[model samples]
Target: MTTQQGTALTHALAEVPGPLPTSGVIHVATPHTSRFTIVGNHLAQHAELSLTAIGLGTHIQSLPTGSRIGIKSLAARFPEGETRIATALRELEAHGYLHRTRVRLANGRITTRTVFRNQPGPTGAPHPEPPTPTSAPAPAPAPAPAAAPAPAPAPTSAPVPAPAPTPGPAPTPPATRGSVPVPAPEPAPVPSASRPAPVPQTHPPAPAPSCPARKGPARLLPQPRELTAELRQTASMLLADLRRHAPELVLSEADIERLTPATATWLERDARPETIRQALTTDLPQPVKYPAKFVRHRLTVLLPPPLPGTEELPPDRPTLVIPMQNCEGCERGYRSRVPGHCRGCRAQLSAA
Candidate 1:
């Protein structure tokens, strides 16, 4: 080609448009210089072109080359909503970037009768135009009558007849007591062959016999008072018996000494009668000594009735006897003294 012809062709191709081909497609030179005509040429060559192919992802493709596609088609392509593609199309049309056309298809033939675009059009090309404004007209005035008439005064007249009083009272009926109604007999239930036979009733499995009344008194037996001399004597006797039976219980000398005073105080003040009872009744046979600290502080003493033929008490089982002594360290026990440690040696202990 000649230099001028080649330059013209290059310029024409440079401004080639409607929309560029997809990234992978080749852009062929075309004789058209108009961007719209270039785009139409590309569209004709490709048969179909997506707005996305031209880097117009947001632009709607519902507008056909020569006809307007329905909103449903737009919705199907962009199911997300009009806000995405439809908005983009509206914006592009508003900014003169795109155009739309409305056409009708009849008898298998398509006809484009209207075109919508921001650009001015040639004779037959439809162009987008601003809507015309219409103002409302003033209302018509009311008509005047030809003549005026004078008003007349009103006059009083005869009174209306009072409505006739309701006719004479209806005839009175004799008072009679209603008869007592008889209850209807319930109908016998019909038996069905398909239904299972009813099982014979046996004396409702004689309500499992009630447990025998407890042998001892029903009400909880009153625990023996700890303060009484009798209760202390009983506890001492029990402790001695336990010790004699089970020597392995490891009642250290110190433990015994400490318990002796605590036992005395516990017996004197009647402290924890329940604990005393449990100690006596526990199944284990072990030496029982009143915690020493408690005995020193509270000084409880219990003296039970003397056993027959026993005066000084036998050596095998010595009775617990608490003697009053001067106060040593404050009489708090392990749990009460060092809550977070073992009181015996002041060693740290875990919280319960």
Candidate 2:
């Protein structure tokens, strides 16, 4: 873990006893990052690298020509646990730095093909811990061996008879008893609709009913609708100020309608207009790719935490689950952690 110890370890690995791989580090550039950066990032958390794994990687990269690496061989060379060495190799493969293929030898036996990649390799490489083949080659047929001896027969015995039941005397019946008489059936009554109505005298006309009671607006949600024209203009001005921070972002009418409620939320929390503006604009990078996302994260962070008690709504109120994204293909929505794609579309892509 110390500097001197790491240098000594590196030197020791450099003089490893047999033939080594002849691979060297190569730089590759992509739109996002290089292959080395990707691998390093996977190994490096918060810009700090794991010492043992990174050392193993450096050693693997410096291996000489025709040198093959395997879990068992690396385990023998490394003083650490075999499982740990295997895991590091797996990490290497996951980051596309290493690939392994199954090679059949001339002697009718198979071995591994260890391919060291300085940059990202092509897709569809075999697994590092390749599975044991469920269907193996058929074995050659052999001649039958000597047969076993037969068993001897036993002597026959006479069968036994089962016992019969004993006879019993019969008893006389009791004095004669008469059966009860059945009742006659009754007919069903006629329906009231089929009967005639009685004659009635004419009555005076009733006065017209009073006007029906006025009902409130049929809004789906009781959203705030009483904001004055002045407040709306102020909301528009605040949004315009947010736009100055990231001019690349464009807002639609619907987006404005949706965002006005957010500004209102900040105001209700007693956030000052200048403070809100700073929250939306302060420290923003130039040429922002996703202004909506930038503003969303800042707004969420600036939100005041809920009160200690009574933060939760009453149980009687129904919980509303808002979908984060809707599938472009199926048009169904889901509250997924990942953006843009739903479960169905993901599965559909895999199948395709």
Candidate 3:
């Protein structure tokens, strides 16, 4: 709106005839012609969403396609920290204003895909707009009330006397410099013996005790074996090369030297160098404060159990022994699994 028009409108409102309200809001709306988003009132006045979530939703809707809305990126752009921003994003996601999914690409790389909806309607339908109010046609003007009969003609010589004004309630007089104000009477005090005893306040009963949470079995470091030169060198190389996989895991020579023995323990248990590296590097925590300490903790806690040797395995149960039996056709002592003829007797029978 133009400045002159706004000023005129304000003056017009001020000149209104009736008494103005003592409280409540008055809106002076202006049309937007550029750089504006069409956010629906459903989102703007959502009952469940917090102010931060609604605002974040609107901001996301206003941004052009391909703009980064990741927590870190948004945290950098706005004053809100990553935790609050993450919470706002979660709220948006829970309320269907935002959707996020982890997608795996053809090249075996994983990435997050986010979608922001301006109006999250069920069944993918657009939210209906509020109907505009239509003004009713003004009623036909009512016939003017008939004028009262002209007052009885008064004598030309006598002037008609004016009617007396109706009286109203008298207004209170303001306090004067010489006036002495009346003081309110004080409440009478009761004797201590006559006063009732004060009742003691009671509190609600305490809640029942909850069971303690179960914890996972503790991880204890395995017994160490003699560290061979080959094992030590391999462990040191693995520890030093960790930075190649995760730059945050960079360690000094002394740190690597101190942690080599722990890593060597994994190697002594027949754990491969690749496995050891993967355990150390995969899923590294954000902002690794002390890389050396983190590596040591992982090396000790995630140590693989030593493989069992052949002699260490329990032996199988002994096989059952078969009983001997005499051959029926041999007429001589012979052994067989069943009562069958010996080879000589069978051959003689065949020849006959």
Candidate maximizing lDDT = 3
lDDT of 1 by residue, 245-264 (tens): 44433344554443443454
Pick by TM-score: 1 or 2, better one: 2
- Candidate ordering by lDDT (highest first): 3, 2, 1
Error of 1 at 315 (Å): 99
- Whose TM-score is higher: candidate 1's or candidate 3's? 3
**Candidate 1: residue 46 Cα off by (Å):** 21
Q: Give candidate 3 misplaced runs (Cα > 4 Å).
A: 1-21, 104-108, 123-223, 226-352
| TM-score to true structure, per model | 0.16, 0.27, 0.38
Residue 268, candidate 2: Cα error in Å is 1.5
Candidate 3 per-residue C-alpha lDDT over 1-352 given as tens digits, one digit per residue, 9 for 90 to 100: 6999989988867776666677885544567999998776878887788899889999998998789998889999999998888888877766656666555799999776566666452323234553111111111111211111111122121132232112111111122111122111111111121131211110111111112245777555444588888888888899989999999998999998888888888988889889988999988889999998888889888888889999999998899776566667756656666777777887988999
TM-score of 2: 0.27
What tens-digit string does per-residue lDDT give for candidate 2 at 1-352?
A: 6999989766766666555557974333235653342232233331232566566777786676476566678888878887788777666555445555554799989755565554333332333432212111111101111110010010011111121111111010011011011001111111111121110110111111112246665323112335556556666578766666556656656666656666666665556788788778777778777766666556655665434446566557687876577777787888865567678788989899
